[model samples]
Target: MANNTSSSRTDAGALVRYYLLRAVVAAAWVAAAFAIGVANPVAAGILLVLYPAWDAFANARDAQANGGVRANIPQALNTAVSAAVALGVLAALRIDPRLVLVLFGVWAVLAGLLQLAIGVRRWRTYGAQWAMVLSGAQSALAGGFFIKSAAAPAMPAIAVVAPYAAFGAFYFLVSAILLAVTTRRRGATA
Candidate 1:
């Protein structure tokens, strides 16, 4: 029982930290997109590539912190997918912005499904994963919207995707808060 409690506490702490970091990164990305991505095409391209690269790095870190990739298959797959998407974005930027949007949309859909699976699995062990589940669902929906936008006549800009990052930031913040609250309550009870 003691070991289980300690493990749970460790997991909770790691998740809280992960969510907070993810939120901060997303917020900064959105700010940068609005402030720089709009004015400079090169900056916009870099931002597009960085978004998925960050996701890959974040997923890898989370998977490693939680358990080995084998134990966290969903996150592991997400990390791989995000990494591939980052490379795809780099290639697509040279061809067309629409391609970048399409790649992001596909990545978002896949990553969101993986996130949903992770949230469901975690919910069995930790009760405060509702925010994560909701975030995953919202992410999938946003991906669909992105796909639709990609088909539009006008070329999509990095600013067009800023709202997705904003929502991501909000969800991560909520998850962090939820985990922090749950940890406090568990500590009090213990």
Candidate 2:
């Protein structure tokens, strides 16, 4: 029993660290986009592309760690598809306000859904996993707003980018806090 308890604590600690790292990376990406603005479409596209790609890679790594099996194959596939579509859209679009908003909005919704799926699967096992679910929900909501704005002829520069940046930041912030709490819980149990 003691050994089992210790093992569980260790697992919880590892989970916490995982989420914290994800949050930090997310926050950094958002900050970079906000600072750079969308002046350079190529740069913005690169940034947008990298985050989901990084996440897909991370998910792959997690699967490898679990004995050569990716537990969330569907979610992984979704991330890959979403990232691909996002890049393709950005590359093909003409940088008009409407197109840019639609691209970002679509990406956000797809990514959020993937995250939510993963979070739901892990909820029973991980205490702070729900944060990812919340983040996913928020992302979808923000995406909806962006899509609605696209119907308009013109949107402010910030309108297109700000939602993405804000949601990314918020998602990361919540993820970080959840990880911190999970880490603390692990320490207490240990």
Top candidate (lDDT): 1
lDDT of 2 by residue, 62-105 (tens): 55654454566755566576657556555635555466567667
> Which residues of candidate 1, in runs, are more than 4 Å off?
153-155
Q: How far is candidate 2 from the true structure (C-alpha RMSD, Å)?
A: 3.2
How close is every model to the real structure, measured as TM-score? 0.96, 0.74
List runs of model 2 lying over 4 Å from the truth. Answer: 66-70, 93-97, 153-159, 186-190
Backbone clashes for every candidate come to 0, 0
Error of 2 at 175 (Å): 3.1
Which pairs clash inside model 2?
none
The true-versus-predicted C-alpha distance at residue 107 of model 2, in Å, is 2.9
Clashes of 2: 0
Q: Looking at model 2, which ten-residue stretch has the lowest summed lDDT?
A: 153-162
Write the residue-wise lDDT of candidate 1 on 36-79 in tens digits: 88889999999999999999999998989887899999999999
